[model samples]
Target chain A: MSHTTKEKSKLLARIRRLKGQMEAVERALEAEMPCGDILNLVASVRGAVNGLMGELIEDHIRMHVVDPGTETDSERAKGAADLIDVVRMYLK
Target chain B: MSHTTKEKSKLLARIRRLKGQMEAVERALEAEMPCGDILNLVASVRGAVNGLMGELIEDHIRMHVVDPGTETDSERAKGAADLIDVVRMYLK
Candidate 1:
């Protein structure tokens, strides 16, 4: 089973929250809210999405790359660290 | 008028696309796809969101901060640039 299969419920919950956030943005626009207020909403949504991405990436690293806690291979550990750095930069 | 009000259609279109992307992520998880594929879907959604945030941030700068084209105030220009830097860091 894929790692995500194990975390399906948690991941689905996050997606549902994201859907709600998108709906909130729609409502804000419909209400013709101020730009600053809308910006704050967008910022919150962006933060949530980043949080979700971080969770998925961490799981990927643990399941696919290296667990880090129980890993004894120096090369694999370094590779996992490097992959994480790249993912962070890309997500940024 | 808020800058977003002027760009409402375009912004809403982006949001709609984001909603679609979120649905795609849900479907992928439900289908029990591999973690790597799910990661890619999440990455795409992240990119779409960052694109939307960038648009909002740029408009915020142009309308609220400084136009950068016609602004003669060095202080305001510097401030806008600094705000953009901070935003980029936060979004990352």
Candidate 2:
């Protein structure tokens, strides 16, 4: 074990469990489940998933953006900016 | 910029947008927005947020848990298990 596992590592597991849920949602849809039930499943999955993301981004801020260990301040700012750009694309 | 923005790196950005949306939801709640509208906002945010997490976990598997560069099989397995435990806590 690397003993260096930080919050980022914890995020990995969060993603996996979420992946299972997402796949289940997909399966439900494929199985021709009722639209209302499928949508409800999608909605709940959405909240659980987003919570995971909020934790992750908060950690990124702690670990990289706001952390003094990141070296160049401008670089970090640019990194943050780039991250925002990427997210906007994903959301769009 | 680091020439190493793997999928997990992209996920960092995904989270920031979700954070913004979450804040918006909180503001809507504080403003006494209609429950239906607020819920819709929350639901959309959740999907976007969870999608980010799924990408992140997939990247982790590629980069750490399932990576050949990870060196130790037992260690990787432990990492995977620890991740599952942590995620279960978060989910509950």
Candidate 3:
């Protein structure tokens, strides 16, 4: 079973919340809210999406790259760290 | 007229696309797709949300903080730059 499958419900919850946030953005735009308010909304959505990405990336690293707690492979650990850095840069 | 108002349609289009991306994530999960593929989907959604945030932040800075082309206040420009840095950090 994939780690994502194990965490399916949790991940879906986050996506559902994200959908709600996007809908809020839609409503805010429809109401013609000011740019500052809209920016705040967009920022919140961005933050939430970042949170989701962080979770998935962490799981991917732990399950696919290296399970740090059990693995003693220094090379794999280093590679996992580098992969994390790249993921951070890409998401950022 | 707020910059967001002027760019309302563009922003909405981006948000709509994000919604679709999120739906894809949900569907993928339901289908028990592998974590790697799911992560890629989430990453694309994150990218799109980041793009939306970038647009709103730029508009907010120009309209509220400092319109670089028109504003001559060095202090305000510096402040806007600092705010952008903080925003980028927060989103990251």
- What DockQ would candidate 1 receive versus the native complex? 0.62
TM-score of chain B of each: 0.78, 0.56, 0.75
lDDT of each: 0.85, 0.51, 0.83
Q: Estimate each model's TM-score.
A: 0.79, 0.34, 0.75
Interface DockQ per candidate: 0.62, 0.04, 0.61
lDDT of 1 by residue, A1-92 (tens): 77899999999998989989998998888788999988988888888888889879978888876976677998888888788778777654
Docking model 2 quality class? incorrect
Write down the DockQ of candidate 2. 0.04
Off by over 4 Å in 3: A72-92, B69-92
Worst 10 residues of 3 chain A by lDDT: A83-92
| Error at B61, model 3, angstroms | 2.9
- Which pairs clash in the backbone of model 2? A46-B46
Candidate 2 stretches greater than 4 Å from native: A1-5, A67-92, B1-92
In candidate 3, list every pair of residues with a backbone clash: none
Candidate 1 at residue A78, lDDT? 80
Task: Please give the C-alpha DockQ score of model 3.
Answer: 0.61
Show model 1 residue runs off by greater than 4 Å.
A69-92, B70-92
